[model samples]
Target: MSWRGKRKVEKPKSEEETSSNKNPKLESSDDSDNLFVCEISKNRRVAVRSWQGNPVVDIREFYVKDGKQLPGKKGISLSMEQWNILRKHMDEIDEAVAENS
Candidate 1:
């Protein structure tokens, strides 16, 4: 008296599909192509990202979570003009740091 043969079994995935599914980070993705982010120092990063079809740069500190570096809530986003102003200030800041050294 057996009655357990009415469910449809799922087809097994191919090796490539299985491997890709197992490691999603290795898949070819272009979602981040519009955003450029990099670490400037420990716990610090600079990101050039596009928002509303406009390019913006952001500088901020980051934190580690789940063994990955994620952007922190504290950050500054700058427009092109603001970025230029920041660059000028950065040059002065660099000289000041060098003078102190």
Candidate 2:
């Protein structure tokens, strides 16, 4: 038997299944609870949010879905420690950007 013939192909999820599988925390309802939110661009944002009972700095891209802004997978969440470390090196980062530009 060919290896390809043994592979299992999964069917795509239905609309109802896809919608129901979305992470609730990524929904717009959570926006009101954010500590701070700044739109870096039309579809990008930076926000401080309480995640799993701890504060986190979230830098994420967003997409419009059903008239609501939803977080996209291309993003990063930094813990307080990580945020502080990044903050401390802001000058260096700025210098690097300046040099590159």
RMSD of each: 16.0, 13.6
lDDT of model 1 at position 2 = 15
Q: Give one digit per residue, the lDDT tens place, for model 2 in 1-101.
A: 31112222122234353334332233234333354345566667676677767888988777765665566778889999999999999999999999999
Residue 88 accuracy (lDDT) in model 1:
78
lDDT of each: 0.53, 0.60
Segments of candidate 1 deviating more than 4 angstroms? 1-33
Question: What residue pairs clash in candidate 2, if any at all?
Answer: none
Q: What tens-digit string does per-residue lDDT give for candidate 1 at 1-101?
A: 21112111122234354334232221113233233344455666565655555667867676766665555777888888888897879978899999999
The candidate that wins on TM-score is 2
- Per-residue lDDT value at 39 in model 1: 46
